[model samples]
Target: MAGMAAKMILGNKLNSVKGELGNLAGGEGEGNDKDEEEAALIEEARQQQEEERKARHAKMEAEREVERQRIREKYGLKKKVAEEAGMPEPDDAGRITRKKKTPAEMQQALQQQEDEEEGFMDTVKGFVAPFAEKLGLDLFK
Candidate 1:
């Protein structure tokens, strides 16, 4: 009878230890869930960082394009802005008549040409007038 009681006590102790082991495994499962949550948070943060980097790169590219446009326009960098605008080319030094121009610019060019012609005429007149009285034939003739 004493051996039977001792056997029953040993069985009860084994059952209690098994129950404690099950509880420990349950707690470890919760820890694994927490680890998963932390990993997900880390992934989310990485994704946000990637998005921010892309946004910053796009912003910088836009700014660079604006700067390039400003520089292009600052000096007349275009070979022919009128041509690019689907109009005739601007002045070309090689051409006898020069390039076709807008009406406004044409007027300006004409005024400049007249001024140059007048200056040249004045110079010629001054050079010939001094010798006119010396000769019977007028140099202006």
Candidate 2:
């Protein structure tokens, strides 16, 4: 009796395996066609949603750009121009153009910056001198 039960279980398993192999070999009849149709429909729906998202994004970007231009105009701000040929064009004649600094002007600016830095360092040394003396660090020295 036990042997007969085991044989029955093995036969059922073998039959199921054969069925799976037949399906893998393209013998699934009408069910495979229905599955393929469903997959194609799903793919089509995904593509449509992607296209709609891209369109919506583009529309939002255009609206944002328009709003930015409106804000700039309200604030009397010039529209930013991209540099063409390594030079930016002025939006209007009334806009002030910056002149290149002469060698003398550049030298003066550098000297002024150095003096300011030295002054800052002197101020810091004055503030830290007492602490340095207490700790015997002699930082300035």
Candidate 3:
């Protein structure tokens, strides 16, 4: 009879442990669902804040541009066109994209610069040659 009672007590304890485990498992699923919902809401709020910040920045930039134009007009300063100034225009993101020079264009510019330098050197040589000749210096050699 004592053995029978011990077996019944053990069985009762096991059933209670299983019930607690089941409750814990179910509670964990609910907690995960709540966490996921909160995370989604936070992400959505962050995106909205980012959009608002961008809009505010754009508005301020526009106002600043208007003020700059007004000041330029007051001073009678003409805004040079990008092309005329040989400067690259700003792209949609407000970044200046440099114009890549073609190989032919680069060669031509280099040649023109060299020609100008050679002309100046020739004038200097003409001025110094007579002095060097008188001194027997032969500076060119």
Candidate 4:
């Protein structure tokens, strides 16, 4: 309840561009330079958008470089060598990376692994059973 409301408020605050300009709400329907002003406003929005995009790109590049450095240090690697080692790309910090498998797929994979392990265990028991029987040494004994 409270948490969800807080998250909704936070998410809205993060995703909005309302604070970029003042009095956007003030000029609702009518405008001074209807066509020209709209065009200019659109251009301004585009320019602001571009600047934000470039800033975000620069920030991401810096963070990625930092992470790459961290990965290299953690793995005891040099930059050139780590670049060549072909590590997987990391997703953004907040995003989930794994694909969601369908229930059928999940069950199939789980059953397959279970079957393999069971088969191996059965084989081992089968091999030992004859020796155990000859020595009057059943598993229950």
Candidate 5:
């Protein structure tokens, strides 16, 4: 009879542990549901942001169109047909009137700018060097 009582106590303890494990697994399912809900909310927020951006872009476009129309009206500029403009209808016919700088010229300009900046920096550094030295600060190092 004592042996039977021991077996019954062990069985009851095992069933209680199994029930706890099942509850833990069920809690994981609830966590997954919460994660899904959070993901959905994030997606919704992204959609709302996209809609707001589009609305802002449309508003800006409308405002720009209105401004352009007002400028045209103020200047008394009439829309001319392609033939009335007395130019080639296609934009490819436009010529580059101004000459572009060559690579060597561009490099020379950049070097000149760098030299000027270096000279200015040197002047500032020289003025600050004595103060820095007095403070025992080796700024150059």
Candidate 6:
């Protein structure tokens, strides 16, 4: 009698434990599904943004081409070499081209630039020296 009652109680407890464990596992599976759905949404948004950027870039390039064509037609200008067009070559980056010089010429240019820099530095040192001395600073040291 007492043994039978104890057996029934143990069986009920075992069944309850099993049910709780099953619920926990189901919860984890639902969480994984939600995570997958969120990841898909993020990837879709990124792809859409990339498509928009490409479209804008292509549109700008097309507009530039149209403007160039218009200018060429209006001026009746043909693409010609700079020398044949009687114009100096255009350096797009605005760098000036100079003829290569002999070693003596290079040394003279370097000396001139050094002299200019020295004069500027002397003026700055003159102004800063007094303040530095007032603060007990020794610039030469």
What TM-score would candidate 4 get against the native? 0.33
* Candidate-wise lDDT, in order: 0.85, 0.89, 0.89, 0.81, 0.87, 0.87
TM-score of model 6 (CA atoms):
0.37
lDDT of 4 by residue, 1-141 (tens): 999999999988866756534347647446555867889999999999999999999999999999999999999986544324677444447767765565889999999999999999899998999989999886834
Q: Which residue pairs come into collision in candidate 5?
A: none
Clashing pairs in 3: none
In order of listing, the candidates' clash counts read 0, 0, 0, 0, 0, 0
lDDT of 4: 0.81
TM-score of each: 0.37, 0.42, 0.42, 0.33, 0.40, 0.37
- Model 2 agreement with the true structure over 13-131: per-residue lDDT tens digits: 99999998988877667787989999999999999999999999999999999999999989998776655556666546575776656588999999999999999999999999999
Candidate 3: 10-residue stretch with minimal lDDT: 89-98
- Candidate 5 regions off by >4 Å? 1-26, 78-91, 95-141
lDDT of 5 by residue, 21-71 (tens): 988877767978999999999999999999999999999999998998888
Looking at model 5, report the run of 10 residues with the lowest lDDT sum.
87-96
Query: Per-residue CA lDDT of candidate 3, range 47-128, in tens?
Result: 9999999999999999998998999999998775755578855454654785667688999999999999999999999999
lDDT of 1 by residue, 12-107 (tens): 999999989988877767978999999999999999999999999999999998988888899857543535577865446677774556688999
- Lowest summed-lDDT stretch of 10 residues in model 1? 76-85
Between 1 and 4, whose lDDT is larger? Answer: 1
Tens-digit lDDT track of model 6 for 1-141? 999999999999999999899888777789789999999999999999999999999999999989988898999976546455678665547557665565889999999999999999999999999999999999956
Clashes of 6: 0
Q: What lDDT, from 0 to 1, does candidate 5 have? A: 0.87
